[model samples]
Target: MTTFEILNGAGADGDQLAGSLNDALCTAAPMVERISGMPLPSHVTVRLLDVAASQALSVVHLGLVYGMAAERLDTEEAFDLAGKLAATAGSRFRMFERITWPLQLGKILYGPTGPELVVVPAAHRAARTSTRQQTVVMGHELTHLAQLELWPDMLTAGPRLRIKAKLTGQPTKSLPVIAPLFEGHAQFVHRDLAAELCGVRARRRLPGEAAPTLRYRATDWLGAVPPLSMVRAIYDRGEKFVSAVMDAGGRSLVHGLFTDEGSLPLLPELLKPELWLARHHPVPAHNAHDQ
Candidate 1:
């Protein structure tokens, strides 16, 4: 099946993905800790799970993705396509190594909270990690770890998205830009650090293979390429767009889009220029994953 179909939920569970998550964590835990600059609370913990555990989490995340797609494409064929996309996403669950920062997406916790990072295996495999790629992911996740370290304070910046969804009977996706401010900032930090630490040269590449958008690759602030979504049209070009933004402002201002929680819509405006003003300033340089 195509990548989109796979995201809808295709493959069987309890297979290589689970084992890999476990293995990658075992091999990576040390480096993750060393490179991650975020402070770890005394009560914080890290875990490596097999397929059963990963599948459980995958079911929840996949369900969310499918439901979102369903709203946009509610016909039988649409639902079928959605399901396939979920399945594809599920099947490839084996191809990622994710870092689950919070128990729920939008919720924040105080110290003595649950494990801060759930590093998945699938991502490790997809990167075909050499020392370089491993460092990149580690840097990416480490940036996330930094965010998690300060998570409690960060939540105040935006409304709790999941809670809003439940109260309004709206899908989390309905918000148009549902990710927490901290999440957006962390994502940008992760991308930036990963490229520097791992020598990724993200400006030259696109975010993913899905679209035909181009992004700018300037100071490589946050190391992010542009949206490969129908947004950018191509990966390389998307990188340039992003690079120009970095050049105009600084990375932190761009990241503040999520953290600032201003009158703007984060996701949809990802391609717009009004927000580019934030980038007009410069983002202070940070070490790889300066948690």
Candidate 2:
């Protein structure tokens, strides 16, 4: 039976998917090093196995959610869909290798916390519609690795805080404040790096890309493609603030922004519109088109 049919039947036998996965891992080895800036640990090996094997370790698995499933998600369709999703998410796929795994059909899986990428026996990263897209996915994952490295304690604290807040009845809302800085930075940097590395820029965001106009004010332009006006507002304002600070005092003021020790706490203040504008001196009121 074809691999797709097998996956659709009983749970996948882990061994069935191993070889293809191994091949993909091998091919992506160089890229993993380049983007991560750290060599893979010699002892850390990648193996492709069925769902059961994946379960042995904490795995970020992909599966189809009912209603989310579309008939066109098979094989090439999966790659295409993933490519499109990566574009919206500002990521790309590298390559797909084969493997055997025990999982029903109609799903995709990967560990959000472990290894850069993974696929079941039925789907592997392959030639995407464009190489630029492949780089987008790969770049985003690399940035995720960078985030983990940069903030090793954040994840550990996240769950504990959530649980503690629940048990004690204290509402903990810090994550929302933290999420935008971290996720937004990652999202921005991933797209920036992907475009730089691949030499391709994505299309601008369209009108519907942003939330309803009532919820967000449109301002600033940073990304070449249309971005959610609010998001663009944040980046543009942030960049302008940072630039003005540097222009006045030079890199010393800017370097402080990158300090990892305790500088993270400053992000919220920096993101504030008033502070951002104050850092750059007053200017005549202007719309995006005027600038």
Candidate 3:
């Protein structure tokens, strides 16, 4: 079992809000381990940021560190970029506070010590969601923390996909190859954790709801790189696909099958999980349903 610490800076409701999230993530941690068969880090931290600090952190910390190259920006680039984002970030801050919903609620950041999970207490200071919704969101984020533990060296689709788009000269055209699985894996574990905790599965989409996708329209000086926000949107796909894969393969998807550096799915396979399923989990037809 894994234990966690909660750091609350979300204002007056911060303690109450952080208490709920701490309870949710702490309760959900073992369930994530059970579903994935991967032991999460022995300890983790979840920080609840108020509206203002969340925006600043998003502008500076996320802006500087996330890029295609394994190496981060040099000092000159970091300072210059930081300044530009800070200047324009006023507009973006309003957007995050008013518009963005759950993505603004929870995310994981890595640093010298280890992975850190930070989240907003509410959509804004004035609005706080129900306890259950907070648990669902925390479960999703906790799964991400588990993913980080399982695949310590793995980078998500955003950076590598961006660099590939640049090289191929097809930013808008290329499909994000790794996103479905990488995100799907987290979503599957998260949703399953939700099911276990709540006794209801949110697997089906309501009528007319669009299937989630990673839309890739190029922008900024770097045409290939997706803006910070869209990075979160892309991972919302593959919950169903992951469920199908796990169903066909076994009770729980093999965390290693996807996490293993040597045997990870290729580009086409990620786009169509069926291809990945067939390649990695070659179940006999008669036994397919049973698995």
* Best candidate, TM-score: 3
> lDDT tens digits, residues 208-250, model 3?
4343222111111122245654554446546655666677766
Instruction: Using lDDT, rank the candidates from best to worst.
Output: 3, 1, 2
Which residue pairs does candidate 3 place in steric collision? none
Q: Whose lDDT is greatest here?
A: 3
Candidate 1, residue 117: Cα displacement in angstroms equals 1.9
Cα error of candidate 2 at position 59, Å? 7.4
The lDDT values for all models are 0.39, 0.36, 0.59
| Candidate 1 C-alpha lDDT tens digits along 1-291 | 000001112133324343433343344344434433344343323333333455456545664546554554445654555566567666655343122211111112221233234433333333333443434443444444455454432332223333334445876554534233334443444455556544653423334423211211121222333321322233233343445554565655444433443423444444454444444343477888986
Candidate 2, position 33, lDDT: 50
RMSD of 3: 8.5
Clash count of each predicted structure:
55, 28, 0
TM-score, every prediction: 0.42, 0.38, 0.68
**Cα lDDT for residue 150, candidate 1:** 48
lDDT of 3 at 157: 34
**Which regions of candidate 3 are displaced past 4 Å?**
72-98, 101-103, 124-128, 164-176, 203-236, 251-253, 261-271, 283-291
Please give the distance, in angstroms, between residue 84's alpha carbon in candidate 1 and its true position after superposition. 22
